[model samples]
Structure formats: structure tokens, C-alpha cells
Target: MIISEGSLVLFFFNSDKKWLIRIENEKKLHTHLGIIDAGSTIGLEYGSHILTNKDKKIFLLPPNTYDFVMKSQRTTQIVYPKDYGYIAARTGLRNGSKVLEIGTGSAALSTFLASIVMPEGHVYTFDVNEDFMSIAKKNLEKSSMDPYVTQGIYDPEKIGQIRDVDLVVIDLGDPWNYLDIIYPSMKSGASVVCICPTMNQLENLATHFFHGGFIDSDCVETFIRKIEAREGKTRPSMRMIGHTTYLGFARKVLK
Candidate 1:
């Protein structure tokens, strides 16, 4: 499809250099490679190419949900993409699924979930920090995910409004503490994932899973290292994301 005015597009220079932008008229984007005339991308089809001011070729690609997740603005550490797929698959999250996100850091994960469950499903995300919530709202709006997301400030009384959700994702400091409160709101066979940056937290959360009528509990941590591929010089990238967080996954069961 042609890149129309105000259309979101991805300018891919390399694995490390990518820019997500809306095609606004008279917009110029400066990069290390060269200056990109954002307006020039209009009418260009995805998979085509654009030339920078230095005559460097940049790939014009379609922006996907993952693109928005990585490009989302943030004040805090957002959930990494590596963990998103695992959580979705483990929880069976799909179209029309309802998700309760306890910590709306940057809305990166929220945007991804919203994209999958769009036009039918919804994500109710809560956070105590108003400034972070404000940033997340903008990120959600940028990805057009605001329609499927319900942003709310954290309040004990307001949480009761969420019920029968398919998935519960907790990213707070002590996710295990909220299990009792959200247990009634989770559907039978629903799944919960807690993000733990430390082993102690993971062990603590896992113990609660056993005592809280959750079955099939497991915890996993992932690391990703990009390979710098070049002719006769392909090797593992020195810069890598290691040990971002541990994901504790469990499914609710009725006693």
C-alpha cells in the first residue's frame, strides 16, 4: 500500500537504526546517516526504498505492533518483546481476550495486547504514577491502541470493576500481594504473569502460586543477542540485552 499523508511508517537503516514516523507534510528527520525528507515517503509503497540526503538507501517498511512497542516513549523500563510472545502463548491470549495489566509503565505491552484483541477485546491497565500514566496514554494514542485500552489510576476500590479477565499481568514490586484481590476477577483457567527482576521475587511469587489455587506454574527468563551479519565477518553482537526480567506464569484453578 502507498504511504499516505499522516500514515505511520518505519524507516529501517539497520538492525540498530530504525525510525517510526508519521508522514506529515514538510517534515524532515535528521539521522546519523543523513537527513530524511519525511514528506518524500508519501505515495511510496512499503518494501520500497528512500534515499537520504547523503544518498544512503533506507528501507521503507510497514509498521507492525512490535515496532510500536519498541519505539514507545518511556520514563521507566518497559517489558521486553522477548517476554511478550511467551506470555501470550502461555495464557492463550487472542482476539476478544480481556487483559488486566497492573503496571502501565510505558504501554508497550499494553499496545501489543491491544493490537491483538482489537475491535472486540480490551486491556484495563492501572498505575499509581500519574506522570507515567500520561506518557503511556500518549504512546497508546500514537499506536491507535487507546480505543482498546482503559487507562486508570490505581485505586483499591476501582479494581473491583474489572472482572472475568482472561489474563492478569502484574509488574509491580510485589505482585504476589495482589493475588488474593484479583483471584475472584480472573476467569477459571485464566493465566497470570508476574514480572520479577530478581530471583527472590520469582521464588516468592511461585510459592504464592502454589498456595493460591494456581496450577501449571512455571518461571522463565530469556536473553537475546543480535548477530551482526556481514560477509566473512558475521559474529555475535557485543551489545546484548541480558536478564531483563523473569516471567512467572501460572493458570488459575477453581478448588
Candidate 2:
């Protein structure tokens, strides 16, 4: 859409993108190419096109969850949207589904979960560090998904009580240690996903999953590659962020 005064827009590009900027009468957008009158974009729809003074074209689109999560100010490594999407889809998170997450980090995944579970579902997130939790709470408040998030500055390891939840996702160093605590709190057939960086951690967690009365425990890792498009040659980009972490998934079952 055409970005007008006060309209939020996502600039689509292979790499460079930004948010914020207001269209005002006689205002201009300064780019390396040149300056473009902001008034020229005032009435465009979402996902429209505009030309800079240098004749460079830019596409504007409505911001999605990915856009916000990737751009949110983060003190810790934020979960990528690819992994976040997998967790949300596999866990069947939607309105009315109660989800729990540990190690809120920057609350990137928590924000995604909150978006899908809105108007009914709720997201309860625990972080041991109050500083991180406070930052996450502020981040959530600025996003559209804030209503579904309940942030708690408590250590999940020491949490003595938890309600039945539809999904439990752990993003901490020792998720396996909490399986015992998480298992009983999960509703029957509820899904659990864990994010770990090492094979040893995944292997060790698998053993805990079986012993903890969980089934179908599996591990997965996602790799993403982007392609560059130009006039003559279109090929995969050389650099990629490979092996962020491995994901382990399991389901709670009646013993």
C-alpha cells in the first residue's frame, strides 16, 4: 500500500528495510538515490509502488509478524520467524488454546504465539531474569499481540504450580530438566517443543522425553536460503544463517 502520513509500512527489499516515517505536506523522503515527495504516496493502498527521486522503485506492504519480530529491539537472540511458524503450526495454537513458554528471551516467539491465540487463547511466559521479562513486556505492549501475553518474572525451574496448557515450549539451556514439571501441567495429548543448540542436548532430552511419559519425540532443524534476482543471473545467495538451533518435539500422553 502507499505509505501515507502516519501509516505503518514495510519496505520490501532483498536486504534493506525500515519502519517509521510520516507523510506530510511538502515533506520528503531522503534516500541515497534522491529525495521523493512524501505527499506523492499519501493515497496509495497497502502493497503499492513508489518511485524515489532517483527513479528507484520501492514496494510498500503491510507489516506482518515476521517483520515486527525481526525488527524488534532485542537484547538476546530472537527466535526466527521460520522456527516460530513451525511451532505455531505444529502446536495448533489458535483462539482458545492456552500456551506456555519458558525463557522468554526477547519474547519474539511469545509475540507470535499471542497473535494466533487472540480473543480467547492466552500465552503465559516465564523468564528467570526480571530485566529480560521487563523488556519483553514493553515490547509486547507495543505490538498488536500484547493482549494475549501474560509475562511472569519467575524461574520455570522453581515454579511449583502450573495449569493445564495446550502447548509447552521451552527455549532454555536445560529444557529436559523441566520435562518432569512440564509433563504434568500439559493437557493430555498436548504438544511440547524444545529449542537447543547442541546434539548432545537433543540426545539427552530424547531420553528424558521417553522416561517422562511423552510420545513421538522427534528432533528437527531448519535451514533457510535466500535467492538473489538480477537481470541475467538468478541464483541462491552465498551466505545463509545455518543451524540456529535444533528443535525437539513431543506429545504428552496418559501413562
Candidate 3:
């Protein structure tokens, strides 16, 4: 397919450096590799190569959900794909599954869930920080997942309007405090996932889940290390993101 305006493209230079860009009619991207005429990419077939001014070869590839989430403009720390994989598996979220997300940081998880729950389902994300929500809105828009998402600044704990949510994802520092507030909005058999950054938070959340209207509680911490998959030197990358956060999963049981 031909490249077009607003199309997301991935420019791969090497394993260490790759850029995700939104194509525009009149734009130039300056990088350490070279200056690339973003407008010149129009009409080029996907996977085509363009030579930069500095003779650097730039290969253009269509970006996927993972690329959009990773390359999204970040105002805060985002949930990495490794954790997302576990969350998705634990929750079994899919198309037509309504999701409620608290603490829409950078909207990475929001975009991921919105992409999966398209055509029939929606994601309602709330954040107290308007600036963060604004940044997240732009990121979701760039990924074309905004249509499936609803962004708001109201606190999910105090909001009385949301109801029948299939999944509730709590990304707040004090997720346990919101468990009582989130319980009423979720439907029976729905799952609630919490992202905790510290052991203290996880311990508190565990205690809350035990007392709250929840069952089958489980917790996990995800670790990801990318390997250099090259011939003769295929091994794990020396540097890796060892710890991001802890994830706690539980199912809401109806009274």
C-alpha cells in the first residue's frame, strides 16, 4: 500500500534505534542518522527504502499496535508490552468487551485495549490530571483508537455514571482505595487488574482484595529482556528493563 498522510510508519535503522513517525505532506525529520524528507515518503510502497541526505538507508514499514504504543508521545511511564501480554491473557479481553481504565498514563494500555475492543466495545478512561489526559488523547488519536475510547478527567471513584464494565484496570498508586468505588461499576464475572510499582502497594492491594467483593486473586511481576538474534552472537541484551511494576489480578464476585 502507498504511504499517505497521517499514516504511521516505522523507520528502522538498527536494532537499537528505530523511529515511529506520522506521515505528513510537509514535514522533515532530523535525526543523528540524517535528515529525512518526510513529505518525500508519499506514494512509496510499504517496505520501500529511501536514501537519506547522509547516505543512510531508511526502510519504511507499517506500524502495528505495539509500535503505536511504544512510539506514542509519553508524558508518563507506560505499561510495557510484556506486562500487557499478561494482562490481556489474565483478563481475556477482546472485541465487545467494555473496559474501564483508571489513571490513563500516556494511554498506552488504553490504546492497546481500544484496538482490541473495536466496532462493538469501548474503553472509558479517567484521569485527574488534565495535562496527562490531553497527552493521552493525542496518543490515542494518532493510533486511530480514539474512536473506541472515551477520555475524562473525573475520578472513577466518585463518578456515579459508569456501569456494567467488563474489566476495570487500576493504574493508580493507591488502587486499593478505589476498589470499593470500582466494584459497583463492574458487571459480575468481570476482572479487575491493578498495576503496583512497589511491594508495599502490592501487599496493601492483596489485603484489600481479600476483604473486597473479589475472588481468585493472583499477582505477578513481569520481566523482559530482549535478545540479540544475530548469527554467531545471539544472546540476551546486556541492558534490559528488569522491573517496571507488579500486576495484580482478581475477579469481581457478585453479592
Candidate 4:
């Protein structure tokens, strides 16, 4: 497995620490282990180990969307992998599914969604903040998922312009505010997933979904805990990723 140029690579120091960077021969990387000449990595096989000047060993590994999200630059809070996984699985998003993503904060959700619905489908992500969109564009470009996503810098009030989407994902403080606009644009039986950080928002969202003619509504909070696998000392990790946000799911049902 040759490490290709422009490929995202991970230098794992340990389970807790790693560096995610694009393979650029012209650049050099500086870390606590020491400085690494990037040009030297051009022909190295993945899983190969290299020793730094300080005699620290590092392993080259393939990178994934999760790594990209964790390492990508962010101007706002991002949706965690745990929540995105649930959204993907529950919504049954697949290749060729048109997705409408509201609130393109850091593009983490869009990046993951684009990876799933590429070559045949597309994601139209909307945000009012041009600055946020600019950062998001960079992230998508870095992930090589830019071709699969269409980002626009427009006010959320203009969401009425979007139409015929298979899935609608809302990442905002008040998802209820857009329900009216989203209802007409969504296809029948289409799934709507909302991420709310507070109970006040959840209550408003659930109420709005019910009255807005969305059925099969369910709200769930996902928590993930990792367990240590050391022999004779295997136990749950002391620190676990917990309480990112509450997810609300519903299906469009025209009255």
C-alpha cells in the first residue's frame, strides 16, 4: 500500500494522539517527536515506521472521514461522529440520494454525507455565513468530496428555494423555525434529522414536526463509550465521548 501523493495520512503516536496531514512532498511537518521531511514519505508503504531525530517511532496509516473531521479547521461546533453515524444509519442514506443539509457549520456533516452519496448523488448545503462557507469549502476540498457537494451562502429564510430532496438534515439551534419551509421542499416519506443541543429546542422541534404533518417522530440522544482491550486489564475507558446532542427524526406526511 503505497502512500499516494495528496492522500490524507495519519501519523499515530498513540491511541490518544495523532497527526492528520495531506501528503505534500514540498512541505515539512513539525511535531513533538521532531521534524519530519515530507519528501521522504513519497514512496513509503503505509504501516511503515519511521524514526525521528529524537528516536521516536511513528506509523503511517490511512486516514478516514472521522480523522478529517477531527483535524479539519473549524469556526463553529461540529456534529460528532456518533451523531452522524446514527443519522446515516437511521436515514438509510446511500449512493444517489439527494440530501439537503441545513446549517453547514464546519462542513463535517457535509463531508461525511458527500462521501456516502457520491458519483450519483449530491448534497446541497446552505449557510448564511460566508466565512463559515469558505472554511467548509476548504474542508470539502481537502477531503476530495467537493465535487459531490454544492454549497451556497444564503440566508436560512430563503430555504424555500430548495426542493425535491430525499433527506433533510438540520444542524441549528432552532430547527423548528425551518420546518414550514422544509415541508414543501421534501419528498413524501423523506426523512428529516435535526440536531438540537438543548431540551427547549427539542421540545419546539418535536411540537413543530407533529403539527407540520411529519409522522413517525422519534427523538434520541446517542452516547458512545470505548472499552480498553488490554489483556487482564480490559475495561471501559475512563473517558468516553458523551452527550453531544439530541437527534430528532421524522418522515414527511402531507395532510
Largest TM-score belongs to which candidate?
A: 3
lDDT scores of the candidates, listed in order: 0.91, 0.80, 0.89, 0.87
**Candidate 1 lDDT over residue span 129-172, tens digit each:** 88898889999999999999999988767787788899999999
Look at candidate 1 and tell me the lDDT of residue 36: 93
Q: Across residues 16-107, which tens digit of lDDT does each residue of candidate 3 receive?
A: 67888889989889999899888889999999988889999999999889989888889888889888878888998998999999899899
For model 1, state the Cα shift of residue 183 in Å. 0.6
What is the TM-score of each predicted model, taking all chains together? 0.94, 0.83, 0.95, 0.94
Error in Å for residue 17 of model 4: 1.5
Poorest stretch of ten by lDDT in candidate 3: 153-162
Query: Which of the two, 2 or 3, has more TM-score?
Result: 3
Candidate 3 collision pairs:
none
RMSD to native for every prediction? 1.5, 3.2, 1.5, 1.6
Q: Model 2, 1-255: lDDT tens per residue?
A: 355677656655436555433456677767665665556667888777777768777776787777778877798887787787778777777788898888898888898888888879988899877789777876787566778888887654444466789999899889998888777678999999999989999999999998888998879998789889888999999988888899999999998
Query: For this target, which candidate reaches the highest lDDT against the unseen true structure?
Result: 1
Q: Which ten residues in a row have the lowest lDDT in candidate 1?
A: 153-162
* Residue 79 Cα positional deviation in candidate 4, in Å, after optimal superposition: 0.6
**Model 4 residue 158 distance off true place after TM-score fit, in angstroms:** 6.2
Off by over 4 Å in 3: 156-158
